[model samples]
Target: MAKKDKSEKKKKSAKLKDAEREARLEISGDLGTAITQASRSLRTVQTRLLTRSGLYSGQEGVVLLLAAEEGLTPGLLAQRLGVKAPTMTRTIGRMEAQGFVERRGSDADGRQTKVYLTETGRATVDRISSANKALERQATQGLSGKEIKVLMKLLAVVEDNLHAQMPAELPEPIDESEDLAAE
Candidate 1:
């Protein structure tokens, strides 16, 4: 009954292939979920650390950027920070109210306003650096240098792939201001 044996073998092979495909799909789904969970946890930790500096989750980026190069326009800041103009404007307003940054009319172009870090913001620079180093140390506590390097490279590749598939016009960013304010 060679024909019967061959038919049974073929059926088993097809089942195995199906099982492998399902496993791959499950693994991919888990990968996405894990990435999302990790990102959220990291942000939560960062927010907690930033609160000590009287900064929110997003304001630190503005402070750091201005620390490096002062007098950057809100539009340029938004572009560099990968956020919308409205978002940057809101962030700058909040920072100004907190006395971390101040805006002034540009000498070259009166219509344009440039942002600069205030004394308070500069003072927090060292604290922000310490907070960041602490976070890094905590996150990579068990990981080797090679593992961290590999992880960074893998994340970069994933980010590039996702960006390549994104549309020219991205969706609006989530408004985390309320959450930050509550904190």
Candidate 2:
């Protein structure tokens, strides 16, 4: 009878271990979902603020870059922004249509097109800078400086872990110009 009791005890322990593992996995999934939702919410707020400055979500980065240094080629701009060349080309085209930027062929390299900010682009970049400051302040409203720093560190760690598992080469980004035309 004692041997039988010991066997039952072992079974219970195994089941407890399995339950604990399942709970941990569920918590991890919940954390991932929460992070994704938070990112989406922040982007929504940024888009609204950027619209007030006569810019779109991704255009502010371009304007900010050009404001710091004029006459950057699309390839260099795309590399700096970590986007594909075609994507940058489309973005530059839109900014050109908006009268915020102009593209000129490089005198040194005929094949290379360099982007320059118009006067309107310069003023918009200033407004974008101010809006960014306001957005950051609003996002961290109740958090202390130390708390914000800790939060940033934790996020960086999470990003590093994901990057470690990512493939060396990601698939090429698709050009969305055709989709835009269809719309």
Candidate 3:
């Protein structure tokens, strides 16, 4: 029993070492890692600015879209934004609670509800726009116009490559209960 216990300890140590090495290998020189880090930092900065205007990170996108086109059904908005229906529904619900948006039953189809910006929501457009412009200026502080254009093109290529390789639908979330025992 002692020998078996020793062997199990060795196995666990080896697994831990392997996991550490794998993590180091991936982050050191990976483009995806760099992109993820940049995105996270940008989001943090944007969130700070947006919070000052009584908006969350993703909420600005919804406000901008509705500002551009009013009376969009939730389903249509979800499709345009490339988010799931339930996600859009929750966002609209929260925005409605905040008095930023209103949903009215469509005259053509009573079952379908169309979303529109409330007067308060319309007033928020300028603040959102200013926040976005500030973010852009901060992000591009050291880059030249030509360099910025090139960077955009390269990022677009990377995005296109990843999109092409992406799965048609994401898989269900993994169950980590078995792994928790080891932890």
Candidate 4:
């Protein structure tokens, strides 16, 4: 079974390499490559810190958002996060089970459920926020103030482009089989 898994991974890597080479040739300093690599590196560190402290990469953002706004509907949270309702549903399910959040029917709309952070979530999120600030400081140790501002602006542009290009908030697709297998 392990050998098969290894072979499958090797095949996938080879395919990605071919695609990357093709992309690199077509676009000098491919924006996608740089964006993907940087995103992966950040996610790795973020995930490590979050997982170590019993959280997930995007989950902390949810907690923080809820912390700031106590009665955000799930739909509102999804809108804020640029995720689909179902995706928010699943993530909130995990969070709710973990005692990081509580869901209640919206006062305005019985059909809508609101997400609220719990006391435990507040403490957990505060720790994660401190950890994130530390990581950001370490990552930007040598950058000048101007450079940091420029980088932030550039990232904002990228984010805006993505949302502008796609109006629908699609749920981030998951390889459910892999997720279930992990469980």
lDDT of each: 0.91, 0.90, 0.89, 0.85
**Candidate 1 per-residue lDDT over residues 27-133, each given as its tens digit:** 75777877886788788998999999999998888988999999999999999999999999999999999999999999999999999999999998998899899
Maximum-TM-score candidate: 1
Q: Could you report the Cα RMSD, in angstroms, for every candidate shown?
A: 15.8, 16.2, 14.7, 14.7
For model 4, give the 10-residue run with minimal summed lDDT.
Answer: 21-30
- 35-119 per-residue lDDT for model 2 (tens digits): 8866887888899999987788899999989999999999999999989999999999999999899999999999988999999
TM-score of each: 0.75, 0.71, 0.74, 0.70
TM-score head-to-head 3 vs 4, winner: 3
Which window of ten consecutive residues has the lowest lDDT sum in model 2? 21-30
RMSD of 2: 16.2
How many clashes in each structure?
A: 0, 0, 0, 0
On the 0 to 100 scale, the lDDT of residue 183 in model 3 is 97
Best by lDDT: 1
Model 1: how far is 104 from its true place, Å? 0.3
List candidate 2 stretches off by more than 4 Å: 1-29, 165-183
Angstrom error at residue 106, model 1: 0.5
Candidate 3: where are CA atoms >4 Å away? 1-28, 167-183
